[model samples]
Target: MTVLSSSSSRFPYAKGSDGTRRLGYGADYNPEQWPREVWEEDVRLMREAGVNIVSLAIFSWARLQPTAETWEFGWLDDVMDLLHAGGIGVDLATATASPPPWLTAAHPEILPVTASGATVWPGARQHWRPTSPVFRDHALRLVRKLASRYADHPALVAWHVNNELGCHNVYDYSDDAARAFRVWLRRRYEHLDALNHAWATAFWSQRYSDWEQILPPRLAASHPNPTQQLDFKRFSSDALKNHLRAERDILRELTPHTPVTTNFMVMGGTKGMDYADWADEVDFVANDHYVVHGPRDEGARDRDELSFSANLTGALARRRPWFLMEHSTSAVNWQPVNLPKKFGELARDSLLHVAHGADAVCFFQWRQSAAGAEKYHSAMVPHAGADSDVFRSVVELGRTLEALAPLAGSEREPARVAVLFDWDSWWAAEHDSHPTARLDYHTEALAWYAALLRLGVRADVVPAHGTELDGYDLVIAPVLHMVPQTLAKRLTRYVETGGHLVTTYFSGIVDEHDHVWLGGHPGALRELLGIRIEEFGPLADEDTVGVDAGPAGELTGDLWSDRVDVTAPDVEVLARYRTGTYAARPAVTRRAAGRGTAAYVSTRLGVDGLAALLPELLAPAGVTSELPECARGAVEPVVRRDADHRYLFLVNRTDTPVDVPGVEGEVLAGPAVRADGRLSLPPRAVAVLRGPNR
Candidate 1:
């Protein structure tokens, strides 16, 4: 049995106060909603769960600033005192959840104007204009005031700036936004001619003689061009960033020691704000992961997606532990069919988040509400109290976490492989007018990611630009459409020096300006990949192409199909389409570089194709993908390790019983692959298998 740590003791989280590994729950406790007696019960429950951290002041803007200038802290004081007394660290929010009703009445500009030129009202939260200077001025004041008040508080561990920036309808299309957009475009294009050239305005007789002609591209009239639509997405992302930076800068000034992070939605192409760029401003990254396994348990819907998102955040965070900012303890109110968490699914889901580099696991709310939008949402204490199943699961998981602090701080070093994930390219590629509208960048990356995950190979998603690729034995660039010249040279060096580099279709088609690279398909990669594309064709929705992808027989897929010319003599054809006009031709080919090789996947195939491709690719580099049979009905398993410790996480997304291997006299649990060879897992449960004693 794990002994619980006292709340008054120093935080047991190992990655320093702000480095990475930290454990806590996202506290949405509001004593203002309940009586003072209820607040005491909330603390006891949190202590039971071993939740050392809590996110406070979120959605309390209306409560704190009930009137124009009157801010109330009497209720907040009691709540904070109780949490600290219970030994819970606080990630204080600025309480700007929704601008106070009085602020909106006094200053209508604080409200956002939607794309349709309609000004949104104050009832709903997150409707404030991000780019409005007035909003910034007021938001900064609130943050400064809050920081000054809580800067010295020992309970304050971090700062969560504003609840989900840009989560509502796109705002601020008034004159101010138009003016800012014009300024942003000028800085980007430098001159009218360059802007016209990049936007290809000459072809449509849409030449902008003056910068003012660029009226933010879609307020009065929606974007006509695909590239412009993409740029608008990028611009919107920047607008969101500008809002966040305003608060982040102020908070850093008040408390430079504490880390600050805004919750980022995973598997999303946040238009203008690149997560990579955002990382520089944040001390660490945190994302809200809500996994929903649908009713009747046909299949696991949200579990794998959440884990993938966690991994993506971890990759961007550089293996630093991330916080699970928000996850559902039970059924979410917003979903069409609100299904409660299956038995053990909540704990399994939480473990899954931790397995994929989460230091803290926090649910959206701590107390179930009788009113409000999220009232139906589950919490630590349900509307029915501790008798509920959700409360039991929270208590059980909490007790387990208190004993796992040493494991929490440990890092997850991926196996010798890296996946190039570029936010800029994702933004750019979606906006491009490719023949196929179903070009899913997230799905494509997941194809490779899922393959790596199943193999139990640790993969890190690094920016395509300037990230070190020296140590990775194999680097896979999936649909890398925008290639930085510097990255091209690096890839060339990697391939030339006997390092393996793999790129898929649409790999290197454009430069940073979104300009097509002249003279063939995979622009800069042609010389290294030893292939040039003469003509490319898009497959119809019902269409399918077959390729003999090595051991995996006849891989098939729709959407992307390619034809290429093998220019390098040393290149070997690995697989080719067995059907079509280009029948019996090479679909997957590899070129022998000095001591290494570069493989080109000319088409996008399904999961089976990836399973086949990775083995052939990783084998030459001496990398192995483990295929352990999951206990029946269990979701797929994932494993990550530190230098001498291995953490095996198995998720039981299915309703039926599943078996996982158990650990005995071992450092951790799950299957053990010794110097010899062996593997097995007990039942639906997850195991953290530790390595041999050094």
Candidate 2:
């Protein structure tokens, strides 16, 4: 057996007697949904599946707290004892993710209300208003009770704060929300005059004379104030964070030794919670990701969403190994068309996360649900029971995880390039009023990332606000719409100190409050990139213009075009629009400042355009593919290094088998090696190879 050592000293869990940290494998175990007779069977199957950890009591608030005064622990005690006796640890949840129907019935004001004055009824989950004092008090009481009861339990390993906070009711425009929003505004702006200035409330006679009159960004005749809407989003995320902190405090006070975390929905379209802000509150990070199916082509749908999500989650964990808190065993029920994983896809998807930096591989559930909104959702033990192929795959995956136990604490190797992902920018960029309604933040960021993956280059997806830029050789901020002054200075200093930067159109247009920065477009970065945008020319869906790069050839860009003017003599036009009203303007400009270089893109270059342009953009920074010559562009290689070993994860996202030659190493996991020195990865397969650090 190979011994794997961690690069980070902040490993949260203890090591086994063999000096290797076993990779945790389990699912969201809700034994309360089953009979007491079924609980022991669940434990038996868990041990058989090498399930060492299970997240318990995630949505059991109704069962745990039957009424306002009644508290029941007999069933919970039995389940916890059974799990512990079966040698499985528990990520004990506070069960505050959903309040009981009785509680909501007793306190009707706790229900979340939409901007249209529609109350989110109790038929669905996560219907409680985050800002309601009634809800908070009841939630905290239950959390205190759970903590006090289970603080010394042997099964407890970590405290699961709340199930995917703000998943549904992130924003509540009720009177309670209005009150909390006012209090939040008062704390943020200090006075009504400052609030007026920040929100630019002078427009349309909307100037606020009193804080009490201010309301949540509810329905208006026209569009609401953009700044007010932005602040309301901020307050909504903060409100959920406050709830988490309220529960986290109780858990920490009672169980100081146990770590606390909540599952973050870090997929493409999830925008409710700003996870970067939430990451600091957790002891370790965990994320739930499912395949994003859309009107997109099949290949595009399967194009490594899991890897992208896990990489972002790992970056949120500060490059430490984070937990794969929840994913489906096969197809998910929520998408327009739910599709099952093809052969070998389950292991492929699971290992892809491990390749990024997942220490655990868990799922949404242990057993298939017989009823509920997610009855058809896939699970470890599927609807077909223990004899099913899903169960076999689950058992096989558990064995594979045990084989890869030495990789539990390993971290991904530091990358020379990083892609900036900011929630503030996401919120601000996608506002009702923007240059282009078609502008998607994650799509643009993923375009850059997918290009890098195609070139077999590993890149960190970091938040633009709080991340340190000194470590990276090249930084790319795609559609960074909201740029605070501090971040602007940091980027300036980073470029001044010789780090390369690439920012796209609609970037740096506003400050933290969605207030447009004066001077010119691409606000604070105009001086660094040596370009001033006079106006934005948004293209229609059918409209596209050609940008002629000298050697990279003509690239077609759409959605947005900025009329750029070169401010300095040293600013070189790398690409220019070949047609359209802004034909002669620079589509892409590069400038050398002090010892660094900055490139400004004036349009949204789709994936193909970026694939053509990135090589030229990254060449000056001396960033190259880490994969072998034969594997470059064919197999996706992610390198993670420790003191003794270099783990290379090669994932074949294509439909055909890829032969990656000139690779010499011991196959740690995945497909078997060919007769030659090449690694043969089948379609949707993954290869984890370990070798000495070269």
The model with the greatest TM-score is: 2
Which pairs of residues collide in candidate 2? none
Model 1 ranges off by over 4 Å: 1-22, 169-172, 219-223, 268-272, 292-301, 626-683, 692-694
Tens digit per residue, CA lDDT, model 1, 1-694: 0011112212224454556544565455666788778778778777776677788888887787777678777777777778888878888888875787778888888777766778888776876876678877877878887888888887877888887666674446776777778888888879888888887787667888887777654443433665565566667778878777888888888888877878877643333456666665566677776654445442333554566677767766666567778877888887787888767667777777777777788887888899988889888778988887888888878765654555676555664787887776776677635757778776677678666755556566666764677778898998898886877888999888878998998878887767788899889788889998877767878888888877766787567778878999999898988876567778898999888899998778865578667788887788764434444224455555556666655554455544444332243433353433333433445555554434
Q: Residue by residue across 637-669, what tens digits does model 2's lDDT show?
A: 777776778888888877678888777788878
After superposition, the stretches of candidate 2 with alpha carbons farther than 4 Å from their true spots are 1-14, 17-19, 296-298, 672-676
lDDT of 1: 0.71
TM-score of every model?
A: 0.89, 0.96
lDDT for model 2, on a 0 to 1 scale? 0.85
Residue 305 lDDT in candidate 1? 56
Give the total clashing residue pairs for model 1.
14
Candidate No. with top lDDT: 2
Q: How does candidate 1 fare on TM-score?
A: 0.89
